[model samples]
Target: MAFRRKNWMAGMLLATTFVVAPLANAADRVKFILDWAYQSQHSMFTIPADDGTYAELDLNVQVDRGAGSGDTVAKVASGAYEMGVADFYSMLRFNSQNPDNKLMAVMAVDDRSALAVASLSATGIKTPAELKGKTIASPAGDASRQLFPLFAQANNIDESSISWNNISIELREPILRRGDADAITGHLTTISMAIDAIGMKRDDIQFMAYSDYGVELVGHVVVARPEYVQSNPDVVRRFLRGAVHGYKKMVADPQLAVASIRKRDPMANADIELARLKMSLDYRMLTPNVQKNGISSVSPERIQRSIDQVGPVFGVDPSTKAADIYTTEYLPDRAELQLPPTGPASSTP
Candidate 1:
């Protein structure tokens, strides 16, 4: 009887060990870097994290803030990180310059470019035509700054007539508010930061959206090294699954999404980030095209148009293949890509 009991105990101990070991090692480690600092605009990544969406998908992920879209692409290609959210045009330029070190966009977030010229109403600089003879401030590395020449060509605004002040991101809005700059070029989303961070009023500002002014550029996209995507296709799909889930929840309750961002960066202002996220969703993310075609997908004609517009600006040869910039091979099914209805609560912001 004693020998039988001892054998049973040993069997139970081995069974417990097997169960606990697999649980300990189940999650796959993945790292994602964002295009810029942790702000409301990045809530799509953070909300999923706060809600355990990534963990549910068996991914152990770390989300880090970045310096710029260009810097984010370099880090991903250098193998410092597995994935990044960056301006698709920047990725196109990078791939054009270094075909050997290629990266491809898996999912596009902002279907329409947020690049714009912003100014205080006091300056009375509302139209792109008004930009001539005005001193404009922008960071040397800003996407808007790099693409301003193209915006100028499209609007027929004289680039040489405008004096440029290469200001830092922290000071871009402040300098404009102080009358040191007659205008600034940045994303439309920057309007929220100007209001929240610098205490400027909403009605006191005006923006000339590049999309409205004939520069039909695309905005942020999820990019990974070609080798990484080839090796880890399932990982890419799973990450997108989590992303779609988070974004749906965000549309339903933006306050909840902003709360998640605050958890990640406790220093963030909840009201401000919430406002930024709403503006991005309205002006940058959910365009008429995205609503009709669905999220995470772009019309081939629009993509080609973007390629044509941006290729020459970045010095990418006309011969450079547009197919090298993006791919849909790893996207989740269309059913899962549909966003929830944009409720009145979300529209309030």
Candidate 2:
């Protein structure tokens, strides 16, 4: 009888394993690529990923670093990555060029443009007009560089007057420090922090944000191929829910969010990342529009304005509509995306 009892227990254990295995494997695997290396802004994805937010939604997400916005757009359009964080304007250009393989933004993450032309105070570059006849160092595929023509058009800077020095991403700040270039164009927070990392005070750098110069373009967004989004609508919705939870958590406890970056990149400086995260939140992510409308929401008029501004610069297909670029179907409910009162602050480093 004891032997029979032992055998029954063993049989139950076997049955349990069989039952749990499929459930364990049932999670929808997702590969999420970022616009650049892991930074504090990325905590919106990493925090939720590490803290069981994605798991709660049955999502097994793998976050990977990206080369740049342009690369991320291409990778997602090619279906190499199911989702990616990328510049909205860069995706616009890609869609215009590849209408058949269009990528669409499922969520507008950064409501304000961080695209800027930054220089040391010593450069005496006080305005966008002053950027003419100067050397601007940028990556060949940088979104900021791609959008410079639009910036120049709005600010009346002759696009032909500025010389673009195509450099690798690693050299962006170093070239500026060495004075190899008079200024650099990239995400404002990223450039400022990089300058600060290399022994220069962020305040010493002067930034001419595109938004301030009549180029009110939207910033980075979460993107996926339109076909993938249509086929896996539920998966996209779940991912956005998890992402909103992550962003809310990051805003509530920035220090925790910054620390989460170390899980993927052990050498990342939490202090610097925290500062970067805060700068982005203050200037880009948590803007008045985002605060009022909730995260991932866009105004139709504003998006139309952006499209109007970017259309000529990118030579976008005349038929491309605002609806072609973004969709609100996957965003979480407004309540879930609302920021906390104590936004972007931390109790400790």
Candidate 3:
């Protein structure tokens, strides 16, 4: 995982010249793959398209939307893209299936999981407890779907009583709207899009966000293959630097981010920006442990603890290398984290 130290030293000199030389425009053509299609939270990766931010780091990134999270990891391991974003647990599950396909997490976009049960306001379903005996529209084989049983237990809802309707997005909206299903297993971002699509304001819907119910879990991350990081540490560092700035700007003004997303994809769910931004902020996705320490800081203990919790279920060796799964080297330093001072904190709809 070594690189030419001399080149890195020169890069440091370039950093010193930032204010004086007015950091020249980025000159590298970098490509990153997304775990799924684009949406609001992707502001970190899309800010280059939103504004002229990438030029400063001598980086130009092309974003590709496709490939499931599991497949995305394989592509990165194969050096198919400079970076890819995928669910945090996908790596664990992937390792369970094939240990050699190791990919590394760089920056986690979310501090905790946002999975939840969403329902229409017309139904008077205000909490997860109300979801008992209701039909739940779920995507078959979804990790969250499988985890729903445990979450249901956590909420004291009888998992057996809740009917499961294997469904897709197109049908989910209609099912809830038509009263076929009382609620759907959804992330806050999805609920944001759902309400907006129904031409109804959020005030008209009653949703139970999982984080509020004490079901917070880790989420997807900006990732790459360990080999890629070894080959191009500077590239990773520059990209994350710019991305962290993008997220800071996003948390600061999600309305602006909505415009940014719309600029890239006309139909991209811009409405989700408000919910995404609010949820991320309230739950400390951007600011989590930032005030106490720093963003992107993962202790070896924290990593090891999480490994121990899931290793048994996934069949990973208990002592599997925690350091191999992620690296904080490419992340920005204290000054660069630069999370905008917290404004008013609020909950997600």
Best-matching candidate per TM-score: 1
Candidate 1 lDDT score at position 291: 65
Clash pairs, candidate 2, are none
TM-score of 3: 0.78
The C-alpha stretches of model 2 lying farther than 4 A from their native spots are 1-25, 343-349
List the candidates' TM-scores in order: 0.91, 0.90, 0.78
TM-score quality measure for candidate 2: 0.90
Model 1 Cα shift for residue 228 (angstroms): 0.3
Report RMSD for candidate 3. Answer: 8.5
> Which digits, one per residue and each the tens of the lDDT, describe model 2 over residues 266-321?
89998888888888888888887777768877866788889988898888876667
Q: Write the per-residue lDDT of candidate 1 for residues 1-349, one digit (tens) a residue.
A: 9999999999999999999998887887789999988877677787778889999998988899998889999999999999999998889878878879989899988887888888888888878898999899999878788899888999899989999999888888888888899988887887557656777887888878787888888889999998999899999999988887877777678888878777878998887888787788887777666665668768556777788888887887787555666787787888777765553222111
| lDDT of each residue in 201-220, candidate 3, tens digit only | 77766767665675545667
| Candidates sorted by lDDT, best first | 2, 1, 3
Clashes of 2: 0
- Write the candidate numbers in order of decreasing TM-score: 1, 2, 3
TM-score of 1: 0.91
lDDT: worst 10-residue window of model 3:
286-295
Who wins the lDDT comparison?
2
